[model samples]
Target: MSVSIDKTNSVVLSADHITKTIGAKNIVDNLSFDIHQGEIVGLLGPNGAGKTTTIRMIVGLIQMSKGDVKVCGHSVRHQFVKAIRHIGGIIENPEFYPYMSGFDNLKQYQRMSEGVTESRIHEVIKLVGLQDAIHKKVRAYSLGMRQRLGIAQALLHEPSILILDEPTNGLDPAGIREMRDYLKLIAREEGIAILVSSHLLSEMELMCSRVIVIQEGKLVTERSIGSEVQTDQVTISFRVNKTQPALEAVHQLNDVRVIGTDTNRSEIILQLKEEIIPQIIKILGDADVSIYRIEESKQSLEEEFLKWTGGNRIA
Candidate 1:
């Protein structure tokens, strides 16, 4: 599916029909998407689903056999130096010099990248909430502190895009929450587009605005997670006097699936469109089944992810 971006060219990162092939196998097939400024997008798929391969191609770690990746209007393949300047990324765990102080570590990176001023470094240090510990040695810093320092280093050059792979790995609950909030803040305050990849579906739900799901190296679906029920289809639990009759009546509706049923309690859970709820009630009433109560529940991201991945465990 094609994602529509703003016509004003607000897209900071775009993978246009990106494909990766290894010998006879196609790892990524015609994958395309856009991440606009101030947006946080999640790259999600089951293990061996080409999530890493796609990310690697975007960062120019591996070459794409076909198609293109553009960052800030510069082609990654043709204008490697120009395109790379707009991106700040942390692939897997971020590395740091354990003997060096956090401030010194950032200063060292400042030397590697042109145009990183000392004030910008301090600004990013404050942005990541490491002001008090900026002088502390990396060896004395916790995993979360090091992660924040990595982010600060990435931000020093003021890149337009940030890509993080499994950024919350090895973090505690509190640390994870801190990382999530900081990322959102950066996307908003810095007006930068951020793309994150992780196996934690629940955390992705909380952190990402939209998610792209790919399966077996193909795009399965892309969806928004801000609303409880983002799609037209919803899961509703119906309580009635006769479970058999209600089930029989609901089965008559098109595009409806009966997922769970309890005969003793006369309850049945169905996945269908919200607009079809009234029709279902009429059908059950016409069937002479006394309707007790109907409750609509939002499908969690993990449930939707499983549905898209065909029950494959996301790793």
Candidate 2:
């Protein structure tokens, strides 16, 4: 959310340098970013990183008090209908007639959509891997199935740009994996640009080609998936024979922060990088601290979210 919209997505869907005020507070301030074509860009921040506001602006769901936005060369302010026609989104949980069959619900949507057709409806159902369950009533569908249906509807019209927020929140592991693979496939095959927002770091790391991090309604960091962020800290978890000698060896290392200790598992999270890990292991081994195993722990998306949001309480 804080990441300035760069020419990231390979195609620019929406662009802005705008501000929004609700009563006495300015929720979004001078925010600017780009979502390029056919790229999966991530918007991650604390719970309220102006993510929803930005999404709203792109979709013309909310009018920006200032600045300009264009989608596929149509102005969001002047050519709202035309610009929005180029986009598709599922901001929160999509609403549906609870008693309707999934196929019927999609039919209702298809009937109302300006150009989407029955075959397109079938295409999306298959793409979402919901063929077996689509005929089932919405009431019988699991939460994950419902979420997939939401995505199905978003994809129904074949818009050039897609947006999904917290897409994996309630999904089981299998559902999450399926959705990730499907999104990647469509992005490549259809050349559609995508912007996905989530609190789950690993999921974003897996699903996104690039990520834009936000915190406290402000921009924090925007980076590609493998882009290195300076940790200012590194952690190594290992199983060793003795605890005391391990502790002593780590303490001897300069500026190491010994966060925890135990008989079998001692966690030494120091302010360093992966480069120093070998030296630490060698020091402990020479001192007879028989190493069981050592590894660099990967931070979850939530942890990265917290760190980038300055660990601030979400307002």
Candidate 3:
């Protein structure tokens, strides 16, 4: 499945039939996708599915055996410098000088990068919520703080795209939440496109606007997440005083499947259209089944990911 792109936003990153081969094997085979500005797109796959290889190719760490990548219309094959200049990324753990202050570390990166002003450094530090610890040594920072500092350094150059691999790795629940919030803020406030590769499906569902799934080095599907997700049917649970009567009433409806039942709570779960819900409520009421609650539940990203990948564990 292909994701519906927003025509209003500019495409910042485009992978055009990119492929990577080694010896007789194709590690990344004809993968293609486009990430738009201000959108956070998740790249997902199982083990040896070329997620890393694809990311490496995009960042110019590894050359693609076929096709090309474009960043802001600059081709990676013919205009490496220009294409790469629009991107800032962290492959894995972001390293820093342990003894150096976070501010000084960003300054160190600023000296190596072109057109990075001191004000930009301060701006990113505040953007990542590290203003208070900006002057503290890196050694004194937690993993989450260091991650924020690394992001601040990457943003100093004002790149249009940000790429991160396993950005939430080694972070606690709170730290992961913090990272997700900061990334979303950057995407929304700065209008930066973000491509993130992570094994954390739950976090990705919360953080990304869309997801690109691949298996065996090929594209499996790409779909929207979060608020953009739409489906013809939804899973709903009806908690009533009489489960059997409620189930019987629901069976009268067309295109509705009774997926589960919980006699303990007198709940019956059914898969049906949202429009059919009012009819169900009325039918149950007519049947004299006291309706206590009606709740709609959507499938989690992990469930969808497993279905797409045929039960393969995400790497």
Candidate 4:
């Protein structure tokens, strides 16, 4: 059932048919997924979609009513503390000592967080781009900066996976860009798998390799980003030709359609079925028509997410 990187590719953290109930009302119902090493996975849902509840269960902050969770192959229930080695997480808003310097705050976290050290804290601070502001007190930090510090703390022990809830709650455009870049960098360089719950679907489309969408605590969709490879999208332009040849060529292939076109310049969308797009390009080239360029029609991540989930709230 775990098909995407969130649950399939050498799984680092996985939930097997997990359910959570509070006061006789089931909040999370039979949710399941896995997070793989070195992948960034996004969890998206509308309000009251059980996104938060599922996240809490992953972090072990709440007991699941059914099924089980595993972190890096260790059962979260059976191993408890030991299984936590596989992950680091921050739920909702991250908390820190407002009066303490970021360095001091990290130091405190270092003392409490197992298997962390002074040097490790420095490393994490640098990792989050907080090297220049390490000695600054949390009270002076901006909301975005505080989020980075929270991430630095989360990475203190160098866990294989990171789980975050609403990680970008209070950041402006610049801050959001910074956080997005930094998270992508860490996921690529540190080989850390990240699972983030967010309402920012567009941003997640750029940062995540795959996405798991939930609606009303039930799994809506899980899909791999940019997984389709088509060889038929062609670049075409007519120097002094009629639009009829282009129209005729499009009609030749049932999957072919127009993307954009102007008086002189034109683009076509073609899905490869029987042959490569290069064949079409060759045919057009043989017709003595000057070709400008040809390129594949790359699918927008947002479009894929929307298509996969159609993830609006249901009444």
Candidate 5:
């Protein structure tokens, strides 16, 4: 469920040079990024890198030592009531009364929040695909179901930005996929800007359109994911009937290097641009090398994360 971001969309959440300090230590130092409408942005950092601190500041859970956060053009500092009205978040795990039904839990939230109609409650339940289980007591709900219920509670307010911390903390593969799918649904169908913090790199790679990486309380990099990510060179594997001739033919081309080969010596892996692939095929064909298959290997998000963080393991 990859969603394309329209750059023209207005910024929904902005953290402008926000910093958090405790005594002499700066937990989050001057971090800044903007999440646009209909975008799912991932917040990534190694342990103690201020990801949670940054999130806390944005949601107004804690005051920023310096700078400001604006949600839907309302400053969180100057307008706490107005700024917080446009935010819905689950800091860690979503809690519920075990005895209460899922629908009842949402009804309670609706009563606490302002201007949330009963229709909106039903809409969010269906949006998260929990219509069938909405009436079931939350004590009987699975972890995935509980997570969806939490999201529904958060969305009852129709917040412009949804902030989640470790949304998939403990779940099997299927549950993880379910959470990812529903989050994407919220962003695409509801057009809400979502900011998520998670340590699961592989899942983040699949779920997020863009990732904001931090290290030592500083900005490391911000990268686009999936089809939106651009790379000038890719590792291409060419399986041909005659590997030696294919290798020699590709060697004649400039800006191409042989990175690896198969154990059978029937495959040659070269690093070069995709546009020059046809040229390599033509050169191989002229040398009577029959092409069997071709594969282009783009760098995975995990690899890029490691590179950007200088091999620091993500927390």
Candidate 6:
């Protein structure tokens, strides 16, 4: 479950000091980051945080006012076709003809994109978990199923990079989880670099290994999800029979910092480590406090995201 980023991985997508100016306003200001092979990076921001603008620039849909975005060592602006050949994306909801069957829809796309063979279409269909329902008409498919089919179409050419914006917009909880797991599986199994833009903070926390957050069209922070706090201190929470006694016991320890006490739940939150837990428990035991349960409770991605963005609500 360790998702610590490996800096040695080859970079598949590079945005070098990209900026987009509209009249007197700077929509995106000097934003830069890299997405490596087999990595899933989340593009997070508020309603007007330039997430879409940045995606557009990378996919060559909009012209950049300054700087360049390169995919597989090809400049998006200079070599549009060559750069885009390595990319497959769904900016918004994926579209397919309601009258057409899922297999037929993919077949039409295969005709349009060169080298998208029948075998490749079948391969992508299975990749997205649509093998059983692929012959069904598009009108009968659920929103989640359509989303999967859309992803299948995008992957038909086996692009090196996958870009998705608001990918889980209308999905139910189960659908969201399914999409999250599928994306992670694809990134690991195929070594495709994935850039996902979504407002679902919890999903991103579980799915992406790294996230690049932007605020006011500028870089706010880039962080790894599970190890945001990898220093000496580790946050832990203890539920005990006596909350006051547990707090008192843990507060007396020199290394442990008592964050807060939840009297209602008979719990105490503190920052310490595995080795220190035994001492804390011993102190509690001597004080007649019975430990019911103990677990690590790190600050969620939503909490840290709000801190980084100055409480600006994400869309």
Best by TM-score: 3
Candidate 1 collision pairs: none
Location of the lowest summed lDDT over 10 successive residues in candidate 3: 1-10
Q: Rank the candidates by TM-score, best first.
A: 3, 1, 5, 6, 4, 2
Flag regions of model 2 displaced more than 4 Å.
Answer: 1-10, 226-307, 313-315
Ten-residue stretch with the least lDDT total in model 5: 1-10
Residue 41 in model 5: shift from native, Å? 0.3
TM-score (C-alpha) between model 1 and the true structure: 0.78
lDDT of 6 by residue, 246-307 (tens): 76666677777654444334666676667998899899999999988888866788986776
Q: Please identify model 4 stretches exceeding 4 Å from their true place.
A: 1-9, 226-315
How does each model score on lDDT? 0.84, 0.72, 0.85, 0.72, 0.84, 0.84
TM-score, every prediction: 0.78, 0.71, 0.79, 0.74, 0.78, 0.77
Instruction: Indicate the worst ten consecutive residues by lDDT in candidate 1.
Output: 1-10
Those runs of model 1 whose alpha carbons end farther than 4 Å from true positions after fitting are 5-9, 227-297
Q: Which of the numbered candidates is closest to the native, going by highest lDDT?
A: 3
For residues 170-284, could you state the per-residue lDDT of candidate 5 as single tens digits? Answer: 9889999999999999999999999999999999989998788888787766656654444677778788897667767887887676644442326676767788988998999
Candidate 4 yields a Cα-based lDDT of 0.72
* Residue pairs with clashing backbones, model 3: none
RMSD of each: 9.2, 11.6, 10.4, 11.0, 10.7, 10.5
lDDT tens digits by residue: candidate 3, 191-303: 99999999999999999988888887887766666755446778787889987777778778766766445443466767678888889888999999998888875678898
Q: What is the lDDT of residue 104 in candidate 1?
A: 98
lDDT of 4 by residue, 280-306 (tens): 666566655455665443456455445
